[model samples]
Target: MKKLMLFTVIVAISIATKAQQYYDVTKYGAKKDSSTLATKSIAAAIAAASKAGGGTVYFPAGKYLTGPIHLKSNITILIDAGAELHFSDNFDHYLPMVESRYEGVDVFSFSPLFYAYKAENIAIKGRGLINGHGKKWWDYALTFYKNQTARNKYQLLFDSANKNIVLPDDATQMQRGFLRPPFIQPLYCKNVLIEGITITNSPFWTVNPEFCENVTVTGVTINNPKSPNTDGINPSSCRYVHISDCHISVGDDCITIKSGKDVPGRTKAFPAENITITNCTMLSGHGGVVIGSEMSGDVKKVTISNCVFDGTDRGIRIKTTRGRGGVVEDIRVDNIVMKNIRDQAIVLDMEYSKTKPEPVSERTPKFRNIRFSNITAYTKKAMYINGLDEMPVSEISLHDVVFEAETGIVIRNVQDIELRHVRVNTKTGPAVSAEKSSRILIDALSTVKPLMDAPLIRLTDVKEALLTNHWLFDGSHKFADIKGAATSNILLHNNILKGATVTTAADVPTGTVQL
Candidate 1:
């Protein structure tokens, strides 16, 4: 008993001593003035803390301008409430390039503003700010898009790198180096935490953790408006990630989950799994929460709950292309509210990049076992799921969804879909439409104000569909419009039609619909 008590007391004292050890950047010659570059001073502080066997690198209440700050394991960056870490806009400071990934491809690019390679138990916490000062990077990137020669040059560099050609070490951003680094990227890290910070003006995707495990990002606020590719909180090829209580207003996706891309990604074969995102509010972004265009390494077991998205281009989006060979499955989204969505409230598209029709193989992406419940949205378009004709998306389920939009739900090239308690208030088009799909079950599906000229439900080339317990309003003109010779065995049971007519195209065979 005495020995145990002694050990406990020693551990407590050790922890207390470690907590008291703070490596202040000012002591290392970092100036409080924001104009003077304090990159080396900050790096010195971090190095001293690391040499002291892991301590807090403390920033007092002042603005400090610096270049990229490399982090070490067992390090804590604690910024005080009024302190701001303003990163330099000078591209040269990023220097001679580092080992990094660009848009899911492996490349030696500029170092991220806050980066750690192969680190463990690293944290950046406190109520402060991190300013990326990315206007210059954004402007430089825009020039390549405007000038075709610059764009071609960048493409050639990227293509050659993919073919295992090494880029020049001194390549500038205007030359062979065109990729912008993310704001905070911990590559091959473990046990990472980022909390209670306001990050703004990111050069690219902010808070991107690549090849990480056990990451937690909470109480973080990110605001980067009109900044190109400044996605907030993207976890790429990571596992066991938890993100909550974040307010994000960014130029790209507010939160994105990815698992590498293309051949390199497939070769790595690291699946991003067991991710949870909750209590997040998004504004003015491309998508509220997105999964892949880079998910060639497969993504699974993700849940997003209790989130609100306002003024975003889309709400929930999972997109991939034919060349991206992966399976995205076991995704669940619940209790989501979205307003002013400029595009579809929800989209699952397998054709994000158009390519020629190819046979079903490892190159064909697959989406299955995705479920959404208790969602409310006010958007231009409600829902759209467009899978490949060869490899259709399958096993989708939605419950208690209400959408007010200009256009309604459209499903194509899908199978085994179930929608319950789904309501759509649309200005035009059918409330629900499915084509090249099968085994669809829609229960309690209704519309508050249906289009008078259009049918409530439309099916083309669908097989084995069951529409049950639907309540049609008084203004409904047609109940259903069934078409195509391949469509068969459509059963409508216990529906309140409200004097709506059911129409079938001439190509539809007899006994295709049973009332």
Candidate 2:
């Protein structure tokens, strides 16, 4: 007991000593309780702390309502335990709009609530609660979008009343986002860290680090389940990011990594790369850890591991549209545990288009060079990989993957696919279905409880395909669904099946026969 106490004391002392340079807001003439102009005073204290060298600006336990508190370089905004920082809903507080990424486009939108722009080595840490109080804007949007006739008339789908959301460049449209904005956004900054903060119920996205580099968001909890467009952490166009040990359950993706979108993104040509996400748990949302619908430049070199998705939409998803004009490649997702997935456990959709009507320019999803291995999924549906007929998914690999899904696995318009050590056990479904590829290979597959779920390993319009060591058990039907007649150079060898049927051309042999 004495040694344990000593360790705890040492750790506490180390934390305190490391925070030696503290700027207590009360000492800088900031009100502790809700009073006159505590907002400006607290912001001034944070700014002043930066001007006189950088240190930790402490927000004591109370309600500190502010418009927008801008942190300077090398400053840490540490909210003490029991601290609740409430932002004023009055839109006038945040003025002079700044450059920010909204929805998927770069715009000078409403000022982010807790903002840090072009600054270095900043942080928002401490075990306190930071709330945005954004219920008003969300409810307003949900109600406003209920009018169907107005939407059809105005070429709008949802939220027709609000024709557009803006930074109020003209000052008349009203700052809806400004009311309760993105809680914390560090734009074009570097060496950032947002750790040990419980940020909840933001009006907009929780933490968006745009065009920044060297970001480390560790041990943070973001819980906002009702707000629209409240993505937990969107590192748009940033590089060298590490997000780990976080609990994110929002209305949107837990953490969406983006480069850019469409013409502006491709012209700018800046890709988000070198991202690592691990040890994270996500509740209900669009996707657990997602990559682009907005990556136009290029999204590459991403690795996600040691994650859990509970009742979420998907475990790992990569979505993009046709005209988005982004190339997502070189991705690896492994060691993931999932349960109660509504859709496919691992889904690659390049044709995720919104029903909202707009001038059709180029809105298609292009996906290639992806890999998922070492994942165990107990899903409600099977896995899905839907590629474009004109533009196929390239260089894909799935290894050591096991599934117990209700639906079957589907792959289309792919090339250079390698499946090894894969097992599927569905109640009643087909095992494998693939199409439109070249250089395809499947080896070492095992199935269980076969009848409703038959094993169908087939190729369609595929080129140079190969299958070997495919075994089926439990009275299964092999050669389940191979129907693409245009495929060429088919090779099959060393496969075992019971009660499974095989259907192929009479001229082709059972082993080592090239088309």
Candidate 3:
């Protein structure tokens, strides 16, 4: 009993010491006036906290106009409830280029507004706001895009990047002035936590964590207007990432997972693995939860569930192309609700850039073993999966899913797909359509309401398929539509449509059965 009492006393003392180790920015001569530049004062406070063996730098209730704030190891920035860190518009504040990623390729570019590299045990928490004064940056990018010489120079930089060629230097590259930095970026860090912050008006992606481990981004609100390239939370080349309870409404994808690009990405050989996203709300983004146009180092073992996407362009999107040369496999998405989706509710396209297939090499991208279950969506289009001819997507599965849209599910160049207990309700198109695909099993399929011209299921150029146990509710059209010469060995039996019938073109073989 005496030893237990002593241990309690020691623990209480430790907690008390930690509570006292907060350095306020006001003590370092940081005023509340939004006009005055408090960059140096905030930096001094951070340095003081670091010099005292790692402590919290607290920002009291004020509007602090600052520039780039470099984060160090074992330090935390606690912005009080009413404090606001309004970043400066001057690009010179982010000069002396740092090593970071532009899009998916590595480059020496302007540092992110809140930048940390190779740090450990860092956090930026509190219910404050970080506003990236980004109007000037956006206007400058538009001007550069309009200028012919600048646009050509920027295109050359991208072409060089694809060929694994580095440009001369940051100064010469800045002549074009196209690279926009992210709002908060922590590269190659460990034990990073960002919580309870409202981030807005970013020049680029809002919070991007690259090459980091054990990252937790929770209870954060990201509201960037429908500008270009303002993703909410992008985790690239990261491991053990947990994103939960985040409300993201951005211009681009709300949450995208990536791991570098083509040859450079393969060279790094760091796959983004072991990621989990749950209980998040997404609104007004390009995609609710996306994976790649930049997954060249491969992304695997990702799980996204229990998320609501409202008014996004696409619900769940996975896109890559030739020259990416990576394998995306073992992904699972379940229990998702989406509404007002402008595009396909779910999409997996391996022809993102439409780069024609070359000889089978390291540049060929592959997607396999993806599963989606328990999804409900009301959108413009149901789902679209387009795989390449050279390497078809394989082993895709869907169970207990429901989609109501203007169009239906379309599959091309896919193999080994199984849809069990799925319900697709489209107003003007077929419930399921497959072309140039094989080994598909559709069971317990139904529709919301019947259609006159559209069938419940359509198969073209598909082989070795089974369509059975359908519940066509209204039976407005035919039960099944089979066409094309290459389609054979299809069995349609024991469906529960009262007045529906099967229609087959002349080229459909006799081996395709209807009973």
- Compare the candidates by TM-score and give the number of the best one: 1
Instruction: Quote the lDDT for 272 in model 2.
Output: 89
Root-mean-square deviation of each candidate, in angstroms? 3.7, 7.3, 3.8
What is the model-wide C-alpha lDDT for candidate 1? 0.90
lDDT by residue for model 3 (259-314), tens: 97877688887889999999999999999999998898899999999999999999
- Please give each candidate's TM-score: 0.93, 0.85, 0.92
Candidate 3: segments with Cα more than 4 A from true spot: 1-20, 148-177
Quick one: ranking by lDDT, best first? Answer: 1, 3, 2
Q: What lDDT would candidate 2 get against the real structure?
A: 0.75
Model 2 lDDT tens row, 1-515: 99999999999998777557788887777665656446667777787777767788998887666677888898998988888777766555665566666645555555788898899999999998887777865785567545533323212211233335332112222323222357788888999999998987788878988888999999999999756888888888888999999999998888888877666577667788999999999887878888877787778889999999998888788887766777888899989988888888888877776333334344444577788889889887667787776667788888998888886677877777888988877766566777676788888866665664355565556677777887766666555444455656777777775546666654333442442
Evaluate all candidate structures by whole-model CA lDDT and list the values in order: 0.90, 0.75, 0.88
Worst 10 residues of 2 by lDDT: 166-175
Q: Which stretches of candidate 1 lie over 4 Å from their true place?
A: 1-15, 144-176
TM-score of 1: 0.93
Ranking by TM-score: 1, 3, 2
Backbone clashes counted, model 3: 0
